[model samples]
Target: MRPFKKIAGIAMSLALTAAMILPAGVRAEDTATDAPKIVISVGDEQKTPEFKADETKDLEISLKNQGIADAVKVRIAPVIEDANTWPFVVEDMNYERTVETITAGNEVMVKWEGLAVRPEVESKYYKLPFKITYEDGEGKQFQLDRYVFVKAVAADKPEEKPEEPKPEENGEPEGGEAGFSNSDPVVSGGGGGSESGKDAVPRVIVTGFNTDPGAVNAGSDFKLIIHLKNTSTKTAVSNMLFDLQAPSSGTEAAAEAPAFLPSSGSSSIYLDYIPAGGTQDISIALNARADLVQKPYSIAMTMKYEDSNATQYESSSSLAIPVKQAARFEFSELEIAPEAVAVGEEANITCSLYNTGRIKLYNVKAKFQGDGIEGKDVFVGNVDSGATGSIDGIVTATQEMAPDQKCKMIVSYEDESGKASTVEKEFSLTITPEQAPMDMSQMVDMPAEKGFPVLPVVIGAVVVVAAIVILIIVLKRRKKKKESVEEEDLLDEVDRFTEDE
Candidate 1:
């Protein structure tokens, strides 16, 4: 009983101390600062994306933020380790992807394409791990571990007699050839297969392909080299006719003009023969359309050939060629309001960012720099093709500039492949010196302004002098009249005295 009471007392004391130290109603702010629950999943067959050895493929995953707070600066990288055979990309290549922010209840997709799987891995399922790190609501970074399953299947091949099943082994093996069939179709690079009679038709497929300059740009001509292989043990294909079908223009499945066309004459090219288990490389000159959009365009190669027994076999394969649109643009009438500013004063800069190319521009930003002024960098998120984005900002004068100086505005944008491009425009902006404080003594000694009214002041002074002279003349006349009246009164007084005598 004493021990139980002691433990309870300790617990109560700790709870009181924690309550005194922590703030009130703080369940949310602290809890939301933890790592977000980001769920990574794939909606593919059997819930696992399939990959082929010695082939390039794409894998896409969906990320959903289930926590209350948003995940910011989310960086996810497929944990590819060479020591363990998780071969998804070449060495020294950056496979990490960053998401600016994934708000709660929203999902985004991340994909890795052109991933070349190592040719030595056996056919089996692999548990793939992904390293995910993100900032929480309190600007605290944390890591959330997640995993996905991927399936590796054998490369597709022409239908052939499967080897006989081997006897049961003593113990179970991870990936072995114990249970087998003599007639199962193997998965091939072309992603399809067919079965006919006892003797199956030999398959002619494009095992791989490459471009001359490697990167195919729109409106330019490039050489495409395709590798044709006869996946047969003993049969030989001869007199082959390969037709390359470029992707159409419209969204409908119906036929339309293709985005790519052969440089010379027809899309059909001739190949002599491909012996069994042998490969052949054929090159074709193709010119991409100038108006082609920025995306991977699929080209279908239709093959028609004859076997040794004069049997006609037809097979079709398609490959996607990524086409990049050139980033081309020019500023439309640069404008600088008040084209002049004093020290510590601002000038308004306005312009229209026009996208004249077929590709969309992303992360558009602008900054002004010159001899004595600088502007705030403005971020214009995205600008579509044939669209105009407005840039309005202010540039403050940092120092006094010489007469007739020029200031420049630099506009930068990135393409779909993350390649950056910039365009600069220079405009004249005058900077005047700041006004000086006034002094009392200097104000008294300053000269009068130009064009003062000096003639009017002189005329008013002459009029005042003439009025003073007229007043003085009237006063003298009044004094003389008073003296005469006094003398007449005295004479009258003398005559009255003589009559009284």
Candidate 2:
């Protein structure tokens, strides 16, 4: 009986162990069958779509469940940089469901529309991000992320636009051209919209230029005025700068002027902003040297500015002004002989004239006009530019002419421009009887001739001889006079002595 009981207990324990292990395998198979499997793809249905500021567009997302079970707790949420914190926002988001469940071989279409917040602002592109989440029957969650791009266009009325031909796929019009059907997803951010289809470059035009005192003398100041207008329909010009350049042969003279230009060359002026279809004025003061040639010189004005996207734009225009030369002249000293000439003696006279005008003199001629001047004595000729010429001749007075007779002499010349000029001078000649020449025999007592005169030595000897003779006579007379005075005084003293006794 005891042996039979032991066998029964062993059989029971083995059976219980087998039952517990078998069910665990079956439950693992069930959990595997209930696991969720999903695939998510987000894309644009149109190849390229333009959305203006504050505009909304739909994005299509395909969700599929490849497992044998159904997907549950499906949720689609867009994750974006906080528009308020970033100064840009997507105002709204809406979703459209195509089918309730994704079967083993079926797919579900989810469409979402996103709105870009419109602010009274400039231009830029905005990007919005989206994320999709779902769970299977076993409660396993899956997530997928995606993005799309839009633009913030101006709020003005829509302009007329030409229709573009639709692209063909497999040699056929895609989606019949009713609307844009297939496109890649676009991502954008910031306060402005995409300018992909619009002209990214701004256009600049040089309208006109003017200057005060259209004509100027060298070394004078003038003001240059530049006028400009913005022609781009979309861009606002900022930090506009202009360079004023004189003609190739001319230069600017002010030191405080813009230094970006040459010392005698170019200058720059600044403008803060120029809106589309708006105009602005720029003024600059210039100084030209007095020595500048007489001719028309051109002033060229160039403009440079940046667009809304920081792109550089440039343009230029030119205007011309005439530069005139100033007037200026100098005279030469007049020449006369002795300033005092004896009658019957010849006198020489000479005079010269010069032109100092900035302008050239053409066909220049000189003439002399005065009394007692003979036609042959007067000299006349052309004075070459920037040069001096003289007139010289001898004048002889008649022997019978009265003494101290004065005669006027004149000199004249014509400018290269055929202008006449004159100068006058006066001189006198004295009349005196002529003396005969001395005989050679009278010169025998003289020593060998030397340059200059020996009259100074002869005068000195005469003075010394006269001084010696006067001294000798003065000593002899003083001795005789002293003796005679002594005799007279003695007799007077004798008489005085008798009277006293």
Candidate 3:
């Protein structure tokens, strides 16, 4: 009994470890409309390509540019931080591959010469984060983090499930078994744990899961339906109880509060029976914590059930569900410099953009539209949550606008899922008509307009005449002085002659 307890503890530990290491598919955030979006695909249904252990496999990764611009100077590298998390290692410890460019509406296939999986690697879905850095056609630098899902399977993992005996020989009618059809793939003992040695113990696992609304937002209640299956073909199981929780590392923040909690105050779910190769579904209401970060969280299920012999067995499985924070924002009142303008003139428009929600606004832009004005798109770039951005643009008047005209300022943005959202704000703009040019012939015959500098010209002439009169009087006085000096000299000469006689 103690050995059985030890085995169950080992199984639970492995499940939690795998949950912490595995990655949910991807958030698939949208790039700017003019930028390139590169994604890797290897033609797997789950986006997970299978690799065998202890093999140096050659991988061909299809990198597709999903935007209108070309991705230039593209560099891709695999980020491996832990040996326990990643089953594959880089070749020659060089993790990077460079590409010249990938044009729009096309794809480039890159080959990895050697990607060696560890000899002791377990069978599971392993997503390795690939860092891609590139520039858009307009020379804007961008960095993207994409995960490549690599499904690592131990050499002895496959083909054993299909080789089991058919369940129809156990008195179950044919075609009536569609309730738990064998066609749907089930996970009995492939990842994290295996029941291969315990052939008598029936293994049950979670096949698939989905939420009601499909989009689960943080700080909201949602219904989660988990599809489970009994993989044992010959044994009928009954008296089952399942316990669910979101596995967290022993960090201070995680230990303080769980990311997800049960809405009904209990995480235990009970079920009666699932016949051989049968399936069951368990639905529960859950509330995502308000403070949970925007990411995919893993949920671990500890399933305890019984076999036909009343022998109780315990197994664990996990699945990751993505939760998103709602994107919210608001605009301040539009401020238009010179609210009124004439045709062919320009007006500057601006507004304050605030991110009011927890989600970041990607590629934020504002555009102005009206009958008489031509405005370019105002790019505000990415606005983090609780941050502010500015929307500014100069719009030129193209033609005369109608009276009491109302113009629209449209703001556009995208969420992580590539969903576009727009907001329209209306403001009044006054545009006067363009004036006609005056003809030169009409100006020639036209008299000067009223008050056309008549007083200024009269004062100018009076000052000029006064200066000329003063100059004439000064010249006459200088001539009289010269004659008086000559008369004095003649008198002096006559006096000298009288003295000599």
Kindly list the per-residue Cα lDDT of model 3 for residues 403-496, writing each as its tens digit: 5888899999988666889989998878988533222233333333344553444445444544544454455567678788888898888999
- Tell me, by TM-score, which candidate is best: 1
Residue 390 error, candidate 3, Å = 1.8
Could you give candidate 1's per-residue lDDT for residues 120-192 as a string of tens digits? 6545445567777776555456664455556665566696785763322122122321111112223233323
Off by over 4 Å in 2: 1-211, 227-238, 246-266, 273-280, 296-300, 307-310, 318-321, 335-350, 355-359, 363-385, 389-501
Name the better of 2 and 3 by lDDT.
3
> What number of backbone clashes does candidate 3 have, counting pairs of residues 3 or more apart or in separate chains?
0
Model 3 reaches what TM-score against the true structure? Answer: 0.47
> How high is the CA lDDT of each candidate model?
0.67, 0.51, 0.67
Q: Residue 476 of model 3: what lDDT?
A: 54
The candidate 3 region of ten consecutive residues with least summed lDDT is 23-32
Ranking by lDDT: 3, 1, 2
Supply every candidate's count of residue pairs whose N, Cα or C atoms clash at under 3 angstroms.
Answer: 4, 31, 0
lDDT of 1 at 66: 57
